[model samples]
Structures are given as C-alpha cells and as structure tokens.
Target chain A: MASNAGVAQSRALPGPVRFITSSIGAKVVMAVSGFVLVGFVLVHMIGNLQIFLGPEAINRYGNFLQGLGELLWVFRLGLLAALIAHVASAARLVILNQSARPINYSHNDYVQVKFAARTMPISGIVVLAFIIFHLAHFTGGKVQPELFHFQDELGQHDIYAMVTLGFQNWFISGFYIVANALLALHLSHGVSSMFQTLGVTAPAWRPLTHALGPVIGTIIFIGNVGIPLACSLGLVAIPAGAM
Target chain B: MHLTLHVWRQKSANDKGRLVQYEVDNISSDMSFLEMLDVFNESLIAKGEEPVAFDHDCREGICGACSLVINGIPHGPDEGTTVCQLHMRRFKDGDTIYIEPWRAKAFPVIRDLIVDRTAFDRIQQAGGFITINTGGAPDANALPIAKTEADLAMDAAACIGCGACVAACPNASAMLFVGAKVSQFLHLPQGHPERARRVKAMVEQMDAEGFGNCTNHYECMAACPKEIDVRVIAELNLEFMKAKISGRE
Candidate 1:
C-alpha cells in the first residue's frame, strides 16, 4: 500500500497544473474572468454617466483615457485576455455538458433552474456580439463615420456628440436597450453562480449570494439603459458648439 | 387504475433502445410503482413476450437500486421518495406515463432501465475508505461527536447512490453524489486522517468518469430522492481547494 501511494504521487501531475486541467479549475477560471468583465462593465457605465455633466466633462473624460496612451492599450489588452479566457472556458463547459448526456430524454423537467440559467449560452453570445458592435461604433469609428469622428471646440474627440447622436437614432438606442437587457439576464445567473463556484457562500449566507445576482444585474441594466433612454428623449443633449 | 406506460426497451448496451408502449389494467392505487411493474412483467410472462428489465432490490427506498425517470422527473412525481416507495395513487386513472433510464455518458444503458452504475462504485473505491489498523470494534463512546456535526454527517451519508441527480441535471453532473460522499466523511472526526487524500482521489475519479461539471443549477437538489442539499457541493469544493493548496506544500 505504501509503495502504491508513492507510485500514485509520482504519477500525479503538479497541483496547480492539474487544477487548470480539472473540471472545477475550468469553472474557477470562468468565475474569475467573469468578475473582471463585470467590473469593467460597471466602471464603463459610471464613466458614460458623466455625459450627463455635458460636453466638457464627458469629452475630457474620453481625452483623459486616450491620454494614457500605451497604458490604455495595456488595460485594453488585459481586458481582451479576460474576455478570451471567459469565453473559452464557457465554450468548453458547454461542449462537455452536451456530451455528458449522450442520449436525449423525450421529456425532461426542470425544477429549480430559472430561465436565465437555461439560456446562459445564448445570452452570453448575444452580449459578446453587442460588445463587438459597441467597440466598432464608438472606438473604431467604423460603424458611423459621420457621428463618431466629430471633435469638440477644444479639439478633443467629441464623445458627447457621438453618444447623444447615436442614442438619438431609434435603431441604435433600441439595440442598446435590448442588448443591455440580455446582458442583465446573463449577469443575473452568472454572478450568483460565480459565488457558488468559488465556494465563498456558506450555507448561512447562501440566500444573500443567490440574491446578489439579480440585484447587481438590475443595477447595471438600469445604469446603462438610463443614458441611452435619456439621450433619445432629449433629456441629455450635445452642447451648442461641441458638435 | 388502468395506465399506459411508454417504457424504454433496449436489448443490450450495444443495441438501440426505443420507447415501447404497454397497457396495464386493474392496477391497484395502493400498489407501489415497482409492484405495478411486477404485475406488468407477469402479464408479459403469461404472453410469452420479453418482459421489460429494470434494476430493483429490497423493494424499498433505502437500497437506492430502483432508478427510473418517470414522466421526466426522477423517481416519478413524488418528492423525496424513490420509485419503490412511490404508490400508484400518485397517478391519475387512464394516464399515460413516460419512463426512461438515467441518461449520462458515465452511465451507459446495460439493458432496459438499467445503466452501468459501476462508475459510482469505482469512484467510491478510489477514496471512500479510511486506512485504519485492523482491530476489534471501538466503543460507541470512544469518539465524542457534537450533535450538529453528527447530524450533518448523517444527512450527507444518507445518500443511497441513486443516479437521479445526473438524470435531472441538464449538465449531467455528479457533483451532488460526490459531494454527499465527501461531506459525509469531512464532517466526521474519524474521517479527518485521510481528508485531503480522500477528496483529491474521489474528485479525480469523478472527473475521469466523464461526468460534467456543476454550474449551480440546483436541479440536483430538487431531483434527489434523499433530498441531499447542493450545499454539500460547496463543501466538496472547499475540500478540493484545501487539498490542492495544502498538497503543494
């Protein structure tokens, strides 16, 4: 028995390396990367809310971000890495889950699983698509050249004009609203699930962790949609000379 | 009660299975689900037809031998009860019921309604024991255990090894079963000697068995005939993390 134990130990992979290849390890990666992305979304939403402060404040905020130059690229690259890890882990889990049930049941019942949990893969894909479209529209200036490349009087990129004009278009605003709603649905399940996967929620605090998902998701949804809705309704408009 | 059952019929593990319908009349409402199957089997014998094969033992819930996904829900529509304990009264007269085997890649169908659950036995064999010196039985009072801890351990130990959790889970994960076994030992003082090794081995075995990962769907808890809580899965995660971290040192 002692010899066998030694043999097993010698044959086993190193702890950290084995963990990355294990099922739980993949889930942990998903949870951690999900946290990073969630943080980025919240910060981005808060920064966008600065548009309510008018052209100077919002454009200056954009200029400040661009001012960082290489530092900004580093941040973007970090975010890109997180996004790739999150999506890769998610896709792998999906494939494994599908293979787990080789035979399909004619009738299957779900008791405690919610709609958001059931449609996670779909909602995740939708959010990914929205992210790509958003970057192309705002950052790349490829989607709408006329509105995206405008400059304010001070010669900074007119972020305020771009945002207000984009939201004023019903199609852009509607798409933003719909995509944000889907993101909320995805986050509602993802957030609580991450807590469970990380094993941070003890039995005593399980209820709180479960409720955290919807609460955070709702806050983000409202914060993001508020900007677009306000812009479309003429509540927040571009400054007189900023365009 | 007269009922129609669309039972899954398979010749062997290598053969294709199909839902074959059968009619059983005059089933007593007081008859347990297995008893109903017995009556149907007797009718098949009388007709010289091949009777539907299923796994059952003790005709009681404790054995965890009887497994059936009745009407899409594991162990029929009844909660916290196995098929052997589920009475026919739970069904309406002339109702059509769908019955299928526990479906998972780790649990392949051996025959009708019987999957090779030896995968579970292999997982248990990996680390589900303590390597204590052989001796006489210890006194009941030899190890003093707190009531709360003992109760929680017993609760987790109550798992009967039924694969309903796998059938009910969309991901077909076995975290609940593995969690229950790990928690049963983790909460006990006697189980501490090999805690890290046990958790690591069992989890590795579980992964090697081709079971899917848990995504916190909570369906396993709902479908469990023994009502094992998913909180045990959290405990399993904790134990695994501890093992991985401590093993590095």
Candidate 2:
C-alpha cells in the first residue's frame, strides 16, 4: 500500500494554468479588474466633486495631479491594464455564455434575476464606450480643443473653465448624465456580484454587499451628475470674465 | 378547467422546433401536471397524431427524471416542486401554458419537449464518487459525523440533478449542480482522499460540456427543485482555488 504513497498524480485534473482559462478563472479576472475599475470610478467622482468648492479647489487639485508627472502616467497605465483585463475577460465569458444556449426559449420568464443583472453586458459596453469619449473630450481635449485653451486669473491652466464651458452645452451635459447613469447601473450590479464571483461573500454577508452596491452606485451618480447639472444651470462656471 | 397549451414540437434533433398550440378541456385541478399531459397525449394518439414526448419517472419528485419548463419557469411555478409533483390546480381556467424542453448547447433536443441530458451523466462520471473496497458492507456509524456537517452534506446531497438550475440561469450555467455534487462529498471524510482530483476533474468536464459561466443571478437557487443553495457554488469555487494553490496535496 505504501508503494505508491505519493505517486498519484494531478495529471488527470486541470492544472493552475488551465484553471485560469476556465469559466471561473475568467470570472476571477473580471472580478479583480472590475474591483480596480470600481475603485477608480469612486475616487474619480469624489475628486471631481471638488468643483463644488469652486475653481480654486478643483483647479488646484487638477494642477496637483498634473504635477505628479510620471507618477500620473503610471496610474493611468495601471488603469489601462485593468480596463483591458476586465474587457477581455468579459469578451471571453460573453462568447461562452452565448454559445451555451444554442437554442432560445420562447418565454424566458425569470424568477429572481433583476434588471441590472440582465443588462450587465449592455450597460458595461455602453459604459466602456462612454469612458473613451470622456477621456477624449476632457483629457485629450480633441473633441473640444477650444475648451483646453482657458486659464484662471492666476494664469494657471483653467480646468474649471474647460469643464464648466463644456458642460454648458446641453448635449455635453446630457451625455454625461446619461452615461454616468449607465455607469451607475453597471456598478450597482457589478459591485456586489463581484464578491460572489470572488467567493468572498459568505451567505450572511450577501445582503450587506448587495445593499452596498446600489448605495455606492447612487452616490457616484449623484456626485458626478451634480457638477454637470450645476454647470448646465449656470450655478458653477468661470463667470463673465474670470479668465 | 379548460386550458390552451403551447408546446415546442420538434420531430428530431435536426428539426427546427416551433410552438404548436392545442386546446385541453376538462382538466381536473387535482390531477398532477404529468397526468394532465398524459391525458392530452392520449387524446392526440386517438386522433392518430404523434403525442408529445416528455420525460418522467416515479411521478414522485425523487428520481429527477421529470424535466420541463412550464410557463417559462422550470418545474412550473411552485417553489421547491418538480413538474411531476406540480398539481394542475396551480393554473386558472382558460389559462395558456407554454411547455418546452431544457435548453442548452450541451442538452440538444431529441424530440417534442425531450432533450438529451446525458451531459449531466457524463459530468457525474468524471469524479462524482469515491472508491470503495469490495466484498462486505462497512459497520454502521463507524465514522463519527457531526450534526452540522451532516446537515450541510445532506442539504447538498438533496440535489436530484434535475437540470432546472441551468434552465433558470441567465447564462444557463451548471455551477449549482456541480457545486451540489462537489459539496456533498466535500463535507464528508470519505471524500477527502480524492478531493483535489474530484474538484478539478468535474469542473474541467463541466467546462468541456460547454455550460455557461456563473454571473451570480442566483436564479439557479430559485428554480432548484431541491432548493440547493448557491453556497455550494461558493464552496466549489473555494475548493478550486485551494486546489490550484496547493495541488497534489
């Protein structure tokens, strides 16, 4: 009996490398990266909320971020990496999810699945597209190069002017509101469900985590949309001749 | 009560199915759902038409042989009830019911309302058991089992492998079934010897069978006839993660 004491092999089983490529593995990737992105969005919204403190606070915050130089690029690259991982894992899972049901049910009456859960892929896709547009419009200044040229009375780069002016346009403000709403919808489901995927949510912890998602989602939505809504309403702006 | 039935009718696996409607009258509320179907099938046979082919066995909820998605919910609308145990009384008069086979790429339709579920059997065969010595039965109560552990094990063991979880899942994932099977053994000492291999093998087999990924909708728990908790799925994930880190242990 001792002849083969340590000889039985895991050769019959999937190895670590293979497990990472499995459905559950792809889920793990998505959850981890989704978490990174979730943290990014929350922090981004909170930082931008400083616009309520008026031009001095938000612009100084922007200047402080810009002064980080290479550190800023590092953070951006890290976010980019997380974005790729999240999207790639999603693409892999979507294909498998689609192919799993070759046939369609005539009546797919779900008992417990909610709207946010059902619309995950679509909401996620829209949010991704919105992220690209947001970066181009705000950071690259390509969409509105005109908004990039303003400076405060102190002659510092006037992010306050750019954002307020950009948001003054109903189209720009409306898009931000709509896109952030979708982002909130995506997070409302993703934030809690990611715990389940990571196997970190105990049965007792489920209710808390599930409730936490929507609350955080609502906060993010309100924080982000509050600025644009204020800007479009002329409550927060660069004034008649502040520049 | 009179009812209208819309059933998916497929001549063969290669045939493209369609919802074919029929009228059923005088269905007794006391009759079980399968009995209602049998009555309809009998009438169809009398008309020289091929009766609908569905799966059922024991007519009691234990065997897990009965499979159906009635009115879009697997095993009908009753919670923790199988189709065979679902009494026709649950429906109202003049109501329209839609019946369809279990839908999945792995579970192909064979005929009217019957799909091949051998995919499940294959998954079970992968590593759903422990090796036992032959010749004589072991002494009863030889191994001391704690109440909590036994309760947990039995809870998972309640799964009858009905595939309703797959029907209810938005992704059509089979994690609940695989979770129940893996957890049933995991809570017992006899299951320890092959723990690593069993988890990995079964999961690999499940993936190869082309089931979808679990996105945590938990509809599987609701549709489950046995009321198997998705906590088993969490255990399955925990075990897989552990196995990955400390393989060959």
Candidate 3:
C-alpha cells in the first residue's frame, strides 16, 4: 500500500473514455445521453400533437420526415447510439450500486426519498421495452400491417389514420396508456436528476430544476396519452376511406 | 422504561454477523443512547456474557466517532444529530430498537457495531487538504472573503466525516462526505491553486475504495448529522468535470 505513496495516480487511457468509466464520469455520460433522449421525446410528442388538426396536417408531417431520406437515417442512428449509451451506463451504475452494499441491513428506512427515484431502474426497463415495441408497431409496420396501410386519395401514407386505427384496439390502447404513464413516471425523476448530474444544481435554481421533471413529464403524458385516448373514445374519427 | 434491543453482534472482521436480541428493564428516559448501551453492557458483564462493543468519543456529537443504525435510520431518529446525542426519551416506554453497524463494502466491520473507516482517511490523504501553508494563524480580515462564500464554505466544512450518509444511501455512496471536503476548499482562494488536481485525485481514490456513485437521491443530505446540503455534490461534479475537461492530472 505504501508503494504508490506521494505519487499521482497513473491514468493509462487518454480521452473522455478514461473518465467515463469513473463513478461520477459515468453519471455525466448518463446525463448527456438522457438529455438527447428527453429532447427527442418532447419533439416527438409535439410533432404527433399535429394529429389533432387533421389527417392532412399529420400526413404531410410524416411525408416531410420521410422525404428527408438519408438525413432521417442520420437522426435515427444518432438517437439509437444515445439510447445504447444511456442504457449501458445505467446498467453499469446499477451493478456498482448493488455491490456497494454486499451485506443487507436488518431494517431499512427512507427519509425524504421519493418513490420515483427508487423505481428508476424498473421504470427504465419498462420504458425501454415500450420503445422497442412502439418502433416495431409503427416504423417497422410489423405489429399491425393492416392499420399501417391506411392512405389518402393523394396515395401517400396517412399517419393520422394509421395511428388512430392502431389505437382503436382495446389491448393496444391499454398498453399505450400504461407505457406512456410509466414513461412519465420515469421522466418525473430522470429530468431532475439529470440536472444534478450535469452540475446545474445551484441552490437558487433548486425550485425550478427540481420541478422540471414532474412538470415536463406530466405535459408529455397528457399530450401523448390524449391522442390514444381520443382514438379509443371515437373523438378522433377514422378518415373516410383510409381506415 | 423497559426496552428490547436487537443488536448486531459480529465476533471479528471475517465473522458473519446477525442481530441478537436482549431485554433491558428500568431504563431512564434522560439517559443518552450510549449511556443506555453502557447500562445494558454492564448487565451482560454481570451475567458473565461477552458484552457488546461500540465506538464512541467526546459524546457531544462533534467527533463523528459514534456510528449506529438505530431502527434502520443512521444516527437514529434525530435529524442533524449523531448517535451519541440520541436520548432515550425519543423512544417509547416499551419500544423495540434495532441497532446495526454502517454497512458498506468500503467499511468492513472491525467488531460488533464498529466498522473500519480508514477508506475515508485514505481518500483524505489522496487530497482532501490544502497543500500550501500560510506559516501560522493569520490576523482577522487579512484576506477578506465574500460573506456568502464564507458561509457556504463553512457549511461544507461542518461535515464531521460521519459515515451516516453512506449507511443511509441505498447505493452506499460517499459523495456527500467527499463533496463536503472538496467543496469547503472550492469556495476559497486557498483551494484555487490545487483545485483541479485535488478533486481528481480524491475522486479516483474514492472510486478505488469501491464506494458507489451518487444518483442525487438526496438521502445523504437527510441522514447527515450536520445536515450538509446536497449542492456540495453538484459542486464536486462541476469541479470534476472542469478538471477532466482542462486535461488536468
């Protein structure tokens, strides 16, 4: 133990990777990747909200995105990388945390710790499964190909009709509601903790930053769940012949 | 008042430990928790049994020597108070109390209700102090510091190096302790010269000690005997990022 005394610890690796494997450095990675994913969720929610306007509005929005060609793939690939990094970092931290306490306490108690904070890993896993299922159901056109075929007289894909039709099924609508709710629950803790990890935690900024997660999470939940709820309730009628 | 105690009894560092229950009667409410333990141990000594062993010093709470997870909460029920300061009145007349040692990979149990905390010392040695010496005590107002910054530094300085934060944290993270030590220096010019190198070395040593990472649960702040704010951890994070980004060793 005395062999390394008075010497600065040797760091073999040079760039960001060296630090990222450290305790706090991994948290920074989680925060940065979380930022990317949260932004994507917000924009995705807002974009999908266009469905409330009409089929033309949302269908045109889809056409515009599909029209991006290679650029869209760039965005998709970038987002996928962020997802992979976020999950990998979270898994690493989870294992480290579990091993930190090899012995169990006879009695466990919590003071001022939030429920959302405690369930982060479970909520994260559920949300990840929802994302994969969502992508397969929507983008890959694999879940329900019949609904995926909805199109307008312009012969372009009608995403509004496609989505509304997909949610018309009771089982699918229920799953969407449950998944979106857990996503909000996940965000309610993730958003606030993200700021702390990024070091945006000045005391003066506590009120605003602490509330950011639950507030933004609720808004996203309302926006996303409203679409599916409206579809199941027949509030958003199927476009004339597209369904 | 009579009390039932479930105390963890470990023979040595390698021995597996468990809660052994005992009953004590005629306890006074005015006795401090440690005093009550003293009474309990005396009874066991009279009965020719191995008495319980616990760590304590100064009994007034500043030393950070006493550690006990009383009824699952570190340092007992009182907020911003250490175990030595916990009085018997806090519990009911016939309450059952569970006492355990600080449980963490970095803090191995040395005996019953006592764990080795030299990992903290090693982290401190890694770089928890100012290397520069001012030669002697300086005159008041020699180097004026802003009131707010001074208060903030003192707030971080109030940490007594208690392991309650780690004991209370679900992850057993030592972020609050390290943050307090690092942050006390961060707000002053005395800490400026070696700031980058200090945070890096201390954090590296902390990780090497196998302490867990902070997840901002704020459990440490609640369990802290000093009630050290969680913002120091944010400051530590910021400083660490700066050091790494600036290519400091």
Candidate 4:
C-alpha cells in the first residue's frame, strides 16, 4: 500500500472539469439567496397589510411607491436580478443532481407521502406560474377589466382600489386563496431545508425547524389570503366608479 | 421479540422475486439484525424452502457488504449503523418488516435481497486504484502530514463501499461514495502526485459506472451507516474543477 501510494503520487496529472464545483458553493448560494427572498416575503406581507387601512390610506401608500419613479425601477431591477440568481442556482443544483443518477426506484416500498416529497419540482413550477400571474395583474398593470377597476388618483393608478376590485371577483379571490395555500406548502419544506443547507440547524433543533416551517408558512398564507376574503365579505367597500 | 419477515425471494438474477413472509417467534432482541435473518434462514432450510439470501460478511458494519433497505429507511431506521450491527430490538414484536435489496439499474439483484454490486466495483476499477508498482518505499514518516488533514482523510476513508448512500438517495446518485473515495486519497501527501489524474479518471469512471448525479437531498448522509459528511462531495467537486484548470499543478 505504501509503495502504491508513492507510485500514484509520482505522476500527478489534471482531469476533466464541470461548471459548478461541488464544495457547498452551490448549496451556499441557494441558501443565501433563499434567505434574501424570505426576507422579501416578510416585507411584502407587511406592505400588503395596508389594504386594511381603507381605500384612501392604501391608495396613498401605492402613490407613495409610484412617486419613487426611477428609484422604483432600480428596486424592481434588483429584485429581478435576485430572482434570476435564485432560479439559476436552483436549476444548476438540480441538474448536477440529475447527472449523478438518472434512473431511480425500481420498486418503491410504501414510504409515507412519498409522492409529495418527490413532486417538489412540479409544485415549485406551479407556484412560479402563480407568482407570474399575480405580479402581472397587480404590478404589471395588466389587470383584466372584468377582474378590477383601475382608477386614476393623484396622478397614479390607485393600486389599493385595483386590489379591492380584483378581490371582489369570486374567481380571482378563490385563485389567490388556492395559490397562497400552495405557497404555504412550498415554504413548509423550503424554510426548513434552507437551514439544513446552511448547516445551521442541529439534529436537536430539527423538530423545531420542522414545526417552525408550517407555523411561519401558515402566517404568510393567512396574511395573503385574509385580504381577498375580507373584500369578498364586503368588509372593504369597492370604489363607486371602479369595476 | 418474535418477528415476521416478508423478505424477497428469488433463485437467480433473471428469476422473478416476491415477498415470502416467515414468522420467527420468540426471537431475542439482543440478536443482531443479520442474526435474526439467519434464524429465519435456518427455519426455511428445514422446511425445504430456499433461505432468504442477503449480502453480508463482516457483522462489524465496516465491510459495506450488508446492503438492505429495511422498512422505508436504508439500513433500518437506526442512524449511522449497518444492517449487520443493527439489533432486532430496533423493531417491535409482531411488526411486519419489509426487506428489499438496493433497487438501482446499476445494482442488479443477484438473488433475493443480494444485489450484484459489481457496478460499484467497476466504478472503482475505472479509477479507484493508484497505478503504483509494488516495490521498496522510503520511510513511512518521510512525508509529514498535518494531523487535521490525516484525521479528515481517515474520516473519508471510513466509507466501506456499502452502496447504502446510493440506495437512500432519491436520484440514486453515487456522488457520496465517489466523493468519499476521491477525498480519502486526495487529502494525503501520497495522493498529491496523481491528484489531477485521479480526479479525472475517477470522475470518468463514475459517469461510466451509470451512477446518478447528486441532487442535494442529503438522504445519503442520513442513510449513511458511516455518517460520512456530504461536505466531502463538495471537496471532490472542488478538486475536480481545480485539476481541470491547473492541469495537475
């Protein structure tokens, strides 16, 4: 063995390479970006709560955002960049993973909820679609006339009125509720996994991590869903000429 | 405690296998998991039925010969313990245990729960060994190594080639096993000479072996009887990239 080691050592030559090196760098990138995204979600949840302040208060908040103009464009660009990085890293990780073993599970002995864990990619894609549609309607200014009543207020589109009008439709509101529920499930796994990827959570802390995922996810779910549910119930009034 | 095992039974690689359940009552919980299986095998022999076949040699959990996905988890539910070392006490009495071989295209079922892990052997053969001739060598301590490096190398060397990591991974990726093997040698002064060549050859061998790429699910680490850290995989990746760029500098 010693002699073999020596001979092997005497002739060092280079080998083939791949784009992403495996030194936890990819996982680290995914985890760090995931963390930033999580923070954005929290901030978004807080900002969305302005809906409860009545149309005038909420519209003022929307106008305040629009007033930023170029600053708002920069912020949007930054968010877009972060989203691209997060997605690219995730895809890279998955691809690298796929290259290792393509065929799996000749015979699956019933592991509980096996399909759910296995369908993470499918769930993620659906959630991605939901995000796109939501942003298109709310931020992209592509709200369907039937879905919302876009109104001019203080030289800007009244986003608060649009949100209220949008939620007034049973179809739109129902879609948001369903999408939020899916988001909750996605976050349930994603949150706990982020900690594991970062190597922060210990085994003892796993139970807490598992429990915390659902709790935080449920809050986000309720916060997002609470809006449309309130509007549908007439607790928030629709603007007179809107919709 | 007594146990009823529904183990897969097959005469040969081409034979169709099915779950053949057997009851072994009043078994001692202190008996190792393999010992329990042995008791059942002995009973089958007396009944003129073929004994349940599984792979195992060293009951000490180091040989990596024992590769069974017990229940849902690989190597039973216990963490960081091989099937041979696992005791019957881990299961409750009257429990209907499901025993299956490592299910992967690369690892063909040789007989019952015994898979022909020659694929792993082939992957190892592709680049596992250093091409050094047997001869006289300098003193053992001629090349000094940091204690930390030695310790880490030892950790990587702990892999027994059991293929449990492959079985547990969702994608059936053998990155952990390949990574462990690569890291074990790369960390030492003896391996530095052929570091780049080793990575290139081993990686090619790994791809050629029909193993899947790692998806970062970390199930391999959890199922690993040796608890070999997934971080070693990262080290392997780094080494491979550096070798490709520097050309063995």
Candidate No. with top TM-score: 3
Model 4 lDDT per residue over B95-175, tens place: 878888886656778998898787767667756766677889978888899998898889989999999888888767787
lDDT of 3 by residue, A1-243 (tens): 531432234366555766898888999999999999999999999999998998888999999999999999999999999999999999999999999999979898889789988898998998899999999998999999987887786878978878888888989888888888989998999999888888875788999999999999999899989989999998897757644
> Taking chain A by itself, what TM-score does each prediction score?
0.91, 0.91, 0.93, 0.78
> Per TM-score, what order, best first?
3, 1, 2, 4
At residue A100, candidate 2 shows an lDDT of 91
Highest DockQ scorer: 3
Better of 2 and 4 by TM-score: 2
lDDT by residue (tens digit), candidate 1, B42-157: 99999999999999998779999999999998898888989999999998899999999999998999999999898788889989887899899999999999998998999999
Which candidate would rank higher by DockQ, 1 or 4? Answer: 1
> Which one wins by TM-score: 3 or 4?
3
Residue pairs with backbone overlap in model 1: none
The positional error of residue B67 in candidate 1, measured at the CA in angstroms, is 0.3
Give me the iRMSD of candidate 3, please.
3.0
Give the TM-score of chain B in candidate 3.
0.98
Please tell me how candidate 4 rates in CAPRI terms.
incorrect
Best by lDDT: 3
User: Global CA lDDT of candidate 2, please?
Assistant: 0.88
Each candidate: RMSD to true structure? Answer: 3.0, 4.3, 2.0, 6.9
Clashes of 4: 11
Give a tens-digit lDDT track for model 1, residues A1-243. Answer: 332343365348876767865778888888999999999999999998899888899999999999999999999999999999999989988999999898989878777889999899999998999999999999998878889778888999999888888888989889899999999999999999888888773677888999999998999999999998999999998656633
lDDT of 4 by residue, A1-243 (tens): 232342344234222113233323455556667677767787888888888976677777777887899999987787777677777777765665565444344445432233434555666677778889888888775756544446655555666667776787899888888888777776776776566555442346767865766787788898988998988887876757654
Calculate candidate 2's fnat: 0.68
